[model samples]
Target: MTAVPLSDDIALRIGLAARILPEIGVARLLRVLDSALGLPPTADTLERLRLRDLRQGADGALADLEPERLKDALAILRGEVGDTQPPPLPEPYVEGELPGSIRVACASDSGEQLDGHFGAARRFLVYQVSTAEIRLIEVREIDDGRAEDDRNSYRAGLIADCQLLYVASIGGPAAAKVVKVDVHPIRLGAGGEIREHLRALQDVLAGHAPPWLAKVMRQGVAPAGGAA
Candidate 1:
């Protein structure tokens, strides 16, 4: 049977899908187009014809084709193109002082939660802190292998470490005095300004912590005390 001519809408949809879904293979692309355009089931002959048109268009070998056919042919041509893998993440910046706003690094082994918040992120850092120089921390790329339990453990460990650093800086007697103080309600701004607020908090704790405790507080951490 002679193949039916593609419609403008179908052609457009196919072209867009090919441009958008470069990872999709030609066979799969055809199937998706067929399903989306309500076209009849695809077969080997149709696939071969589509592939031929695609090759011709890609090599600038096609001319004088109908608009609808040209659209589909262009899509096929694009589908044949391949892309390289994404480049590796760049090194973390540590030229300036670490932000003090009680920064929390949240992650999971599954990568689901991180993906969900991808667009919402303003600034993220992978930090490495030592026991002796707890104040000096280095940021690195987010590790994907850290499981949920590991993340929870890291949170608790960070809180404990920060408290220790705070105590060491302030000395035992003074550290004990304000150990029970509650600082909370951390306010974050809409843009990158929130990181500055965190840095300000860090500056406040410089050389002020006791060896036994990190900075501890609850409530009133937010910028302008606004609700997140």
Candidate 2:
């Protein structure tokens, strides 16, 4: 897709924001701009804008553009955009542990795929407990080599079922140990939904999750009366 030119105001805002939030991507930046300007959905329009030529000068960088361009750009982008579907709930996998039980399952990718795990990529599923049927969620994909800091930031808020899953390709015992420690972290993974779940579970015992997310998590697990 070709890049669209940003208005002088939009370009300045983006440049300033990129400086402040270096981790923010162009799509997210566009979202911020839309909210600030009360612009309608422009995903498709923005996608059409090419980052092709960036002109920088003493007055900071300004994307040169023709007149009456923004409206056309917005219309084109909106037409190309579509509704995004929620990720599919994963199937449950059970692995027995000494005192507790570990269950694994995969969450369907929404639209984006992890860097490495393309065709062979499968989300990792982990659950502990037998009768209760609580599963810890983790996604594994081929390492795309992008910085993990921003991507892993959301680990904190993963629904109780979804936790960050890191898999070691080779070896047996060491990998098992890593997986165990990740599940029972002394500290929750950095930011995002997963951290929120960890904090919520800290005070309460297992089986506690935020109400909204709990609904989805329960659906992914087996029924209370159902066998493991």
Which candidate leads in TM-score? 2
Candidate 1: residue 207 Cα off by (Å): 14
lDDT of 2 by residue, 66-150 (tens): 2122222322232321114333343444333213332322222233221111111123323333333444433332232332443
State each model's CA lDDT, in order: 0.30, 0.32
Per-prediction tally of clashes: 40, 32
How much does each candidate deviate from the true structure in C-alpha RMSD? 19.3, 16.5
**Candidate 1 regions with alpha-carbon error over 4 angstroms:** 1-136, 148-160, 163-191, 202-228
lDDT, residue 65, model 2: 29
What is the C-alpha local distance difference test score of candidate 2? 0.32
